[model samples]
Target: MSKLIIGRYIPGDGPVYRMDPRGKLLATFIFIAIVFLANNWQTYAIACGFCLLAVIATKLPLKTFLQGIRPLVWLILFTALLQLVFTTGGHVYWHWGIFSITSFGLVNSIFIFLRFLMVILISTVLTLTTMPLEIAAGMESLLKPLKYLHVPVEQIALVMAIALRFVPTLMDQTVKIMNAQRTRGVDFNEGGLIQRAKAFVPIIVPLFIESLNVALDLSIAMEARGYQDDKPRSRYRSLHWSHYDLYNLGFFVLLTVLLIIFREH
Candidate 1:
């Protein structure tokens, strides 16, 4: 179960790891927009280039990045298959009972599959480099203006931070529980869909109880520390937009403009 989580951070002093989490989040959104907004192969190619550059920037092993996408392989394939069977354009390449494949569908499927792969890869890279706490802080700072609309920005950010902070911990715990069951001759992977799901019941029930207990304890601890919604929060580490962030932002803006121009053409 621990191994199922792909976004675990690996410590490094690389340029990507040194970047402001806020910038990374913004750039990821820009990259996603570039990919999804694309209507042509050229734009997709450019987006792929940008994704490759991001992977290179991270300085992590290529294997690690590829591994991050493994869990998503089935989803990518499923989406591609749906597009291939449903998209109606160009000449039909193959036809069978209640199924047909066309040139347009083939191209669309490949593009969608690649786009999904790139999105996952980019997000995985972002999470692998940035710490969860930094991400949460950056998110809160970025969304601070929303408080003007009477939104509970602090509480939302705190919840996100806590959730992110516990993902790895919970994953580790799940793995331990699975291993303990396996040692008792339980086979999770050998069952049919319903049976496999049933196997999770034992694991999930324990996990849910433990999680509730932890949440209660955390709330009590926060109250004991005089945590209050009316109070302004300060951080030991602040989110700052530096020259590098500006440069990245400029590059993304140019890329977006180019994509728009290409789409018009």
Candidate 2:
């Protein structure tokens, strides 16, 4: 759990880290589209290769990237198993009532699993490289046009930023609470499904209380600071697009075009 990398930002001087947050967000969106465009093994392989190049460019430790996906292993496996057991069309190698594994099912399962992994990796790279504030600012900039539609863009951005900023904090708090519970004779790992869930009740209740307290405190702080959505705010650091951003965006755009052209429908 300590090794979980989701929603945690690591400060770095890599090219990816220096690119504009908006560019990163756009690239991630495009990459997701590209992933879904993949159909056959060749396209999936290309997608995997693109993700590999991205992971390498981030300059983060391979172990760190792997840790980000570790928690999702079971989810990926479950999805793959569902695809394998349900999908039917190709040659069937085994059959047991409604559970039959066909060649098409196997292929689809493999591709789906790879797709899940690649998507996770790409998203992890974005969070690891960008700070919460940058994310909020980027989102706000991207959604500025929505303000004309009477959308509360700033408030929405603030809410998103705060939620992301608290992820690591909450994870750390959960870990601390779990340890405290363990000291009080709670065994989280040594139990059946229902038993383990019951064990977590003690942990969850206290965590909820703590979260409430934190939220209350934050609300008080914001009130003390006179935070208002209707007021104009000044930024400490403004975002500017550099040549690096252009290069990064261009590379992804070119990659997307190439993927589209070669992707098997």
Candidate 3:
């Protein structure tokens, strides 16, 4: 699995790590939308260059991003294959009974692959650089206007933060449970798909119980600490808008403009 660490955060000192999480979050979303603006090699190059630049800004090892992407390789490839098979037109290189490898399909598949890759890249950059608490705070602040519309922005943010924080914890617990079962002679990979799924039955039942107990314990602890959803709260670490955030905004806006200018008509 190469350790799926999508929601895992790495402690580091760098420009990306220092930038406001709110900006990073906003940029991640905006980038996802803007990535589709590229339709040709020229446009794709520009968009991909921006992604590479943003990645380089993180100052984290390339291996970290590679590990995060490795687990998704098959999914991305499957999507690309769908695009390659279903898309039609342009010069045909090879043709079969129901599938044809046309130049258009090939290019479109590559574009689809790159778009998916860039989106995951930006999201990984956000989660990797920002802490869970900071992400929650950023989300809450960004959604603050929703309070006027009666949305529980704080609770939503809190849930998201908790979910992110628990991803690694749950993964570790799953691993531990699997190892314990292995010690008891559970053969997970020794049989076919059905057999492998059956092997997971023991892991799933105990893991579910453990998860419930953990959640109950957390709720109890929060109750003891007097945490309330409706109460007004102040952060021990408040978020502040900075020149760096403005710079990030400008950088992405410039990229957006470039995409618009260069994209196909």
Candidate 4:
């Protein structure tokens, strides 16, 4: 759980760490969108190169990103397996009992695996580079126009920020709870399908209680601070759009164009 990168932020002085979160957010979204535009080796190769560049730009240890991806390795493999077995098209190599591998399926499975991996890597970069508060601020800045429609944009952004900030805390709690359960003679991995599901009950029950307590504590802290969103609030730190941010967005745009051009017609 600690290995998961959903909300983990590593402070650094690298170029990527210096860009505006809004640009990072938009670039991440665009990268994810353009990933689907890739359909062949050339496009996927470009996509892979783009991912490599992003990871290198983070200027963090390679192991850090690899650890973030470790937990999802099986999921990516399983998805690839399904695509390889069930998808049918092109030259069929083998077919029996709904299990078959065709040329199309083989190609598709590779693409699917690469696609999943690329998305995960890019998302990990975003989380590692940007803090939850920055993410919320960026989102709120972008979403400010929604307030014209009577939407509570600030509250929405605050909720998202809180969720992201709490993810690592929750995961750490889950790990501790799992360890406590293990001490109580519960084995999460040493069980059958039903038994494994039952094993998680001990972990989940306390984790839920812990989550509630955390929430209550947060509420109290906010209340003590006299938290209010009815009006504009001053930011302790302000986000400024920079040329580096524009550069970040532009690189993704170039990657998008490359994918569109190289992808299968």
Identify the leading candidate in terms of TM-score. 3
TM-score of 4: 0.81
Q: Sort every candidate by lDDT, greatest first.
A: 4, 3, 2, 1
- Locate the minimum summed-lDDT window of 10 residues in model 3: 1-10
- Give the Cα RMSD of candidate 1: 2.8
Model 3 per-residue lDDT tens digits across residues 5-27: 79778998878887898898999
- C-alpha root-mean-square deviation, candidate 2: 3.2
- Report clashes for each candidate as comma-separated counts: 0, 0, 0, 0
Q: In terms of TM-score, which candidate is stronger, 1 or 2?
A: 1
Off by over 4 Å in 3: 167-185
Error of 4 at 100 (Å): 1.7
Which of candidates 1 and 4 is the stronger one according to TM-score?
Answer: 1
Cα lDDT of model 1 by residue, 45-94, tens digit? 87788788888888888988877888889989999999999887789988
Clashing pairs in 4: none
Q: Is candidate 1 or candidate 2 better by lDDT?
A: 2
lDDT of 2 at 205: 97
After superposing candidate 1, which stretches have Cα over 4 Å from the reference?
168-203
lDDT of 4 by residue, 1-265 (tens): 4456656899997889999999999999999999999988999999999999999999999999988988889999999999999999899999999899999999999999999999999999999999878988988998889999999998898788788878778888888988888898887888689999999888889989988999999999997898977967777868998988988998998998998888878
lDDT per residue for candidate 2 within 12-95, as digits (tens), equals: 888889889999999899888788888876777788988898888888899989889889999999999999999998999999
Model 2 residue pairs with clashes: none
lDDT of each model, Cα atoms only?
0.84, 0.89, 0.89, 0.90
Give candidates' CA RMSD values in order.
Answer: 2.8, 3.2, 2.5, 3.4
Error of 3 at 133 (Å): 2.8
